[model samples]
Target: SSPPSYQNGLWGHVGKTKTPEDVDALVGPRPGLKGEGHLFDRLSKNRDAVVVLDEIEKAHPAMINEFLLGVLGNGQMQNKKTGETIDIGKSIFILTSNCFQTMITHRYRQEKDDVAALESLHSSLANTIRTWVHSGVSASGKGE
Candidate 1:
């Protein structure tokens, strides 16, 4: 078969258009960076899908809070190109991080189900946050 075609803004057309080639092409030239571009772009485009950024402890602490706020605020983001604001109103955003605790607890409280497994999950989550916060270490322990 022919090679992938990551031309224009075509990477965002996954599942709705052509085959895997289209999806592969979407992962542009810079295989490392551009490959993830489609994922971010699609997450931003979807109106209802809730994209969860797991293992967020890996991100810088300063940015982690802001990132959580943005995701929770319905994909609220700033466009560097146009210096404008954008929102994924239809999407529900959730970010899991290793630092923050209160927000996660608040979110957990909002959930309808109180199953044992769910409670255990929240407890584990809170314990993780406590560990990170008390240790005064960034997720990477890079020491700011």
Candidate 2:
């Protein structure tokens, strides 16, 4: 695996998180004398970053509504302590949730039905990837 493109872009796993506030507090700007004093603020250093909110679904819906909708949609996040606007225009945010990925074989009781669902999802994903790859090839003529 190659290194991350940005300085603090690629975070493999953040363990079991419980909230989006937890997400930002862990990665966003902070208060104190100097301001913008957080791990991400220092690590990203005004560069484009990728923040991965692991186990995102574990967070309360209100936090998701407030946090993700606020920062990601607007490319800004405010420091919770001082309400200072933090710029994330060049940042890339990605989230992952194992609790959300319900394996078909695990979701259902009937073995055959589980297999069917697995096949269906796999087929759908394959088709979507194929179409996306084809479109990229058409556009760039590099994936042929």
lDDT winner among the candidates? 2
Question: On residues 9-50, what C-alpha lDDT tens digit does candidate 2 reach at each position?
Answer: 655333433444444444542344343324344434654666
Candidate with the greatest TM-score versus the true structure: 2
Query: lDDT per prediction?
Result: 0.44, 0.51
Q: Check candidate 2 and list the clashing pairs.
A: none
Residue-by-residue lDDT tens digits, candidate 1, 1-144: 222223222122222313333333332223332233344355455545555444444543433333334445465654322334456566554445444466556767766476775677779867876666455446453322
Model 1 whole-model lDDT (C-alpha atoms): 0.44
Clashes of each: 1, 0
* Deviating ranges (above 4 Å) for candidate 1: 1-40, 73-75, 94-124, 127-144
RMSD of 1: 11.7
Misplaced by over 4 Å in model 2 are 1-6, 10-24, 27-44, 104-144
